[model samples]
Target: MDKAQIKIYGLLENYLEYCKTNGFTDFEIWCEDNIDSANEKGLVQDIYREVNHIADKLFD
Candidate 1:
């Protein structure tokens, strides 16, 4: 895989571990709450957007 794909994969893996650490097994649910908190904190971009960007980077 390319750098972008590798980065995204790593991020997803990290996120999954984070979810497990927090006792969350559902990715969608975890993402929902994470996205909301990210938005509330005015992060550079929300989790969904980051995921999209990563996807684009991987494919493009």
Candidate 2:
């Protein structure tokens, strides 16, 4: 993957770790609920799109 993709993946990994540490067992549910928070934090557009796409696949 390119640097940007790698960076996004790292961010995603960190997010998942945070969720797990905080007792969130359902990734899709957590992501669905907190997507707007990520947007509010100004997450990179590509990362946001990738995360949304992954969440859609997981939930749908």
Candidate 3:
């Protein structure tokens, strides 16, 4: 992956950790805001969906 892709992935990984440690619902607003700011719409949606899923399992 390119630097930007790698960086975004890394950041998303960290975000996942944060969501996992906390709660998915707790991070909903942040996730929405991030998805808005993310320049890559496709990637953002993908990450948002994946993270939300992971967070949901943790929350459950």
Candidate 4:
């Protein structure tokens, strides 16, 4: 994985933890709410794709 991919993966890891800790059952909803935070952290191109990819790997 490239640096961006790795960073996104790490972010998704944290997001998963956040969801588990906070009782959030919907990944899409969490993404909708927190995508801007990812953007603010410098995610741009392929953000959704990358996030989905990481999420699938972790949650599937």
Candidate 5:
């Protein structure tokens, strides 16, 4: 991952952790902001794809 993707990955990982710790509903109510942030530098899809089940954990 490039620096931007790496940074977004870190941010998304933190969000995923929040979802797991706090419950998915209470976190990431809408992922638009996250997507937009990712789009600023990289694709959120790439991050999710690379992380495998992290997408499921965050958005399943």
Candidate 6:
């Protein structure tokens, strides 16, 4: 991958780890409270679906 992609992946991975280790796991409530736009929420849900698709294959 390119340098930008690598950096973003590293940052996201770290953020994911931080969230997992901390008490920020209530994603449904978080989204309900934080996501102000239905369009943005839909986009994020699409991302969740795509990520879960790959994760199910890779980690199953």
The models' CA-based lDDT, in order, is: 0.46, 0.51, 0.61, 0.56, 0.54, 0.47
lDDT of 3 by residue, 1-41 (tens): 85546656766777777766775653334644444344544
Q: Using alpha carbons, what is the TM-score of model 4?
A: 0.43
- How does residue 29 of candidate 4 score in lDDT? 46
Give the higher-lDDT candidate: 1 or 2.
2
Candidate 2 lDDT for residue 30:
42
Model 4 alpha-carbon drift over 4 Å, by segment: 25-60
lDDT by residue (tens digit), candidate 1, 16-59: 56654554343334344433343333332335455545544443
Superposition error at 14 for model 5 (Å): 0.1
Best by TM-score: 3
On lDDT, the leading prediction is: 3
In candidate 4, what are the lDDT values of residues 38-58, reduced to their tens digit? 543455344555555665665
1-60: candidate 6 lDDT, tens digit per residue: 755445445544644555556633433333444455566566446555454454444444
Ten-residue stretch with the least lDDT total in model 5: 23-32
Of 3 and 5, which scores higher on TM-score? 3
Candidate 5: where are CA atoms >4 Å away? 25-42, 45-60
How would you order the candidates by lDDT, starting with the best?
3, 4, 5, 2, 6, 1
Off by over 4 Å in 2: 23-43, 46-60
Predicted structure 2: clash tally: 0
Candidate 5: residue pairs that collide: none
Error of 5 at 12 (Å): 1.9
lDDT of 5 by residue, 1-60 (tens): 766666665667677776666654422333345545545334645444544455465565
